[model samples]
Target: MEYVAGNVANKAGVRLLMACLLAKLHNPLVDVRKPYTRIGGSDSFSGRKYDERYIADFINANALPCNSTSAFLTPAFRNRNAPLVMGLELEGRPPQLYTYVLELLDDVHNRRVEPENLLAEIIRWLLINRNEQQQRIESLLKTLRTTHGAIPLSSEAIVGLIEKHMSLKGTSRIPVLIVAAAYQAAGQYLLEMNLPLQAHNAADVQTGALGDVEITFVGDGKVVTSYEMKDRHVTRGDIDRALQKLEETRKRVDNYIFITTDRIDEQVQDYARSLYTQTDGIEFVILDCIGFLRHYLHLFHRVRTEFLEAYQSLLLAEPSSSVSQAVKEAFLSMRHATEAG
Candidate 1:
């Protein structure tokens, strides 16, 4: 006799009521991408009836295709959907909730490849600009013997050009780049001076312990001068370490020079001077940023006459056997492309 909606099937009147209730309950769901103007009306009762104009327009207006920095680093290109933004956007009392949004955005934007891009661009710029600068110097060198009006090589110009293209601050790669450039410049200077270089390559600069002696010349099988490049702040402790390391090669080396960035404090300068004054048997010298710049400037002037031609020849001569791998590779690629055409 109990007439529950689900169990009362024997009675015809109760069966009809339950059928209507179930039909109403199972009405088709509304599409979220549509507009629902009327609520609890005929539209609500009807099945699968909705307008999608407003939602589509809203999406089109608000969303934009992300212009990523690097095509290779984009998440869309990697076949991944947009990541969910969890509670990381909220500002907590002590700290905020962990958010993967920034990380996600970074991957989408591809900012990680920026360094290599900048490096490649800078190298191309340097090669072209330095070549032009060398041409100007070549003209001046012709008058070197006759006139004092010859234009001087400006180290500031070179350094300024590099700084203009790339900010060396907060970059870990700048030191290595600068040191490598210095080594290249030094090798060119030696070549112009007609001195026989024992070893001058990327290996000499990159694949060694910091502060280790880099002897350039081997005359009569003895090292004449040992050079060390430091792209950091020179501390007394660093100097002590360098001096200790140099002790191992003191018998073979006649002189030792440490070159570093211009930020050398007075303490370091004083310590180096003291070491130079007190030490015997071998000469010790420190070339701070300014000193090194001046040294390079002199080298530029010394080899100005043959700089550009020599540089081009060197690039084409031995592309694989240089410290400037990126530049060399770029140049070689261009050469190959041109030849292919």
Candidate 2:
């Protein structure tokens, strides 16, 4: 007689095995305060004598309780967590503070809320409680300035900042900036490799050309790799133009690399295949921006350290325009060499 295992028994056995394996697996420990500690000291000033009353009042006003007797005794708070709580609290009870201030200003018939007083109070609150949310917002603003092309004071201020600084409407400027940043990072990487290249430069091939190609390293008198960078938005026309330009310039260089911020299109892939089929001896490649970003994020930290060192050294050197350029040139060359290999 053939006997089949019961469905429940089979399922239970699988679950039991999984539970055993899970029990054996090492649990990962995460340090939520790592990012905060990296930027600023971890100790919250909320427990200090001068801050105690302010914090207690703020917490009570918001219906939050202080479980710890001494604020200083409290564990280092995760910066992100604190701000989220504060934002939620402020958003929920809009009538308490923000609305009160707004009504006071509205009551003034011909007068307005004094800009100085408004700014002073904002600054005071930001400083007094050492508001984690305020600090995080400032940090976010600073990062966005570099990463997003420019900073906005508030979410509502984005349009104004974009209009004033970028001139390009919608998401066009964002992509351009992202592409530029990718090229800059890749160029910096190539420079670190000590490739025989001067510096990266992007030039429009034709007038009214929306598309531009960046050449990180022009072949020096010595033959070396020549790279062309394109963004994901590159079209078939752009690829054809770049190939034509590459062929025109190939004789002047040892090798050619085609890098893009996105995956190569089918047309470009077919063209690359044809090049290999023809044995043109020109190498083609595609570098995704996401991968490039991950690679350079680490490199940027190292570069920052090097930059700081060089900057300090410059303080001791005689001040000269030529000297400054020479130093920059040297660093760029070194970076290229490191990247090329």
Candidate 3:
């Protein structure tokens, strides 16, 4: 597929920006994963270590040697499944390019590619195309400075600033917001209860491994709660897997909450209810995103300055202009009511 430059750049930028924002707003002292750092470098078997050596050796052993007159390699010949030597001479990619291309090939072998790799490629392309990446970063920093000055203590506006500069998607935007909100709420809860609380993602909760969030809280001698966020489309199989994961780490968490954005269909809700009923070790609470908004409407109001500003900015700046007026009005009114109190 032809990579659409604007879309690609936006997605890459937002992923990085969101990671940074979440870490800053929620877990300031914690080292959240950064984009574009070396991934798959954990062990020798990861193929990152072997890729260059293997490719070089293969090329030398099999490629036909010729004088410097030939074009380094033809695109078609380079991409073929031939021996490394033949492919290298045919592709004529320089040593640095080879590193990236080999990494790309290794991704194909493993059936997954890290977002950072794509980000690196996008940055490389941008640098080639009149140094756009650096320019965009500069633009983002400038926008951040201007917006913060206008709306001090505006978390929502700060998020919106990053979104505008980075071009984040609505789907990606909500998760980051939810995580930030959860962290803020949990932190306050900890202070009020005079105890620490832990948070974990689905992956760590599943493997009985403590997530960075969980470790940070527990190491501080605080009580920890585990929450798993679910989208409208989550399936029964997904729930089953999550349950299994929770069961694996039952001793670590004090309470388990399942947060969902979509209304649960009756059958699925029934299954969840039954499963929780039967399970003794884990306490389960299902929180609907819509209901949470209503019950905590006041909290929403308290946080309206930042959240509403973000919502409005997104509505105005997004390309489709498809966000509903009612949604915007409701949130704005909620914010206004909270501030009035």
Candidate 4:
């Protein structure tokens, strides 16, 4: 039972890790058992220690003769008879020794199970109870939020924001929620700049534009902005493609913002700068994880309690009668993003 509990904890930690990656949440890798960190996994074992004099004497006594490959030792004869009595057989040699060796081999084989089989069994169990496990986790989160003022999150606040500013509900709402949250916060950033928001989008609401999130400033509405939030590592190819896409929309939108969870390389920045100078009417800017968080943190601060609830809810939420390939693809993308991050 102890062993089963330990393995279940390990598997549960892995599941939480996978979920965090899907939600673009950053958490530290933690040691599994002792003094559990924010999450759990085992660290490498420490080196062994022994008494020096006893170890040296034992080694000297049992040391093999130099350059002797044929040298081997045999076990005492008293233990040999038990295997023969246990039905282990010998073909040509004396019955005792062969039987004893066979018995030892059988014992070893019976004592050890294949690791792959154990993992397969554990994963099967997880799949069977995934929904129930998620519900329990949500309940735990709710309890943590309510019982502790130190917990620092409120679903009531998140739900309020969602109800007031967002038209999203259920699983399909989350991606839109993310987009919406970022969009609303970007508006706050604009307001901070002393520019009033002339027009804005409800989360995922778009004007048939190329960007994921859009906002127009109070001034002529010609000073418009669009933000694309990609929770993944930024690459050179990604920058090039974004610049290419921005070129098409530059005639209409004044600013095209690219936000990612990756550290943008200097070369990508240089390329973007070169494009920026070449472009006539539009501004091109790139923001990394820190930058995106600076704006997105507003929503996080507002809906801290319900944020993870919303994430888990969306993860299990299905918008259609059947799960689609796109949903699986999005999850895969987030998984890769987490690994890369």
lDDT of 1 by residue, 287-328 (tens): 764455445656566543233234334433331222233343
Best by TM-score: 3
Instruction: Give each model's whole-structure lDDT.
Output: 0.37, 0.33, 0.38, 0.38
What is the per-residue lDDT of model 4 for residues 185-288, given as tens digits with 9 covering 90 to 100? 44444442212211222222244355655565544444366666554555667666656665555545667677665467777666666665566656667776
Candidate 4 scores a C-alpha RMSD against the true structure in Å of 23.4
Candidate 2 segments whose C-alpha is farther than 4 A from its true place: 1-237, 249-263, 273-279, 299-301, 304-341
Q: Sorted on lDDT, highest at the top, how do the candidates line up?
A: 4, 3, 1, 2
lDDT value for candidate 3?
0.38
Q: How many backbone clashes does candidate 2 have?
A: 21
User: What does candidate 2's lDDT look like per residue over 183-301, in tens digits?
Assistant: 44344566522222111222444322213333334343343444455545445565566567655554433344455655667766666555543435655545553454344444554
Report the candidate with higher TM-score, 2 versus 3.
3
Instruction: For candidate 3, write residues 1-341 as lDDT tens digits.
Output: 01322332122222222232233233333222221123222221212112233322432343211111111122422223332221243233333443334344344234474434553554444334323433443454444444443434344443333333223233322432443343444444334222222222224644554322231252365435555556654456755766676556555455555566667666765566666446665455566654554444345445544444544454333221122222333333333333333
Model 2 poorest 10 in a row by lDDT: 1-10
Candidate 1 worst ten-residue window by lDDT: 1-10
Residue 215 CA error for candidate 2 (Å)? 5.1
Q: How many residue pairs clash per model?
A: 0, 21, 6, 3
Q: What TM-score number comes out for model 4?
A: 0.35
Error of 3 at 337 (Å): 21
TM-score of 1: 0.37
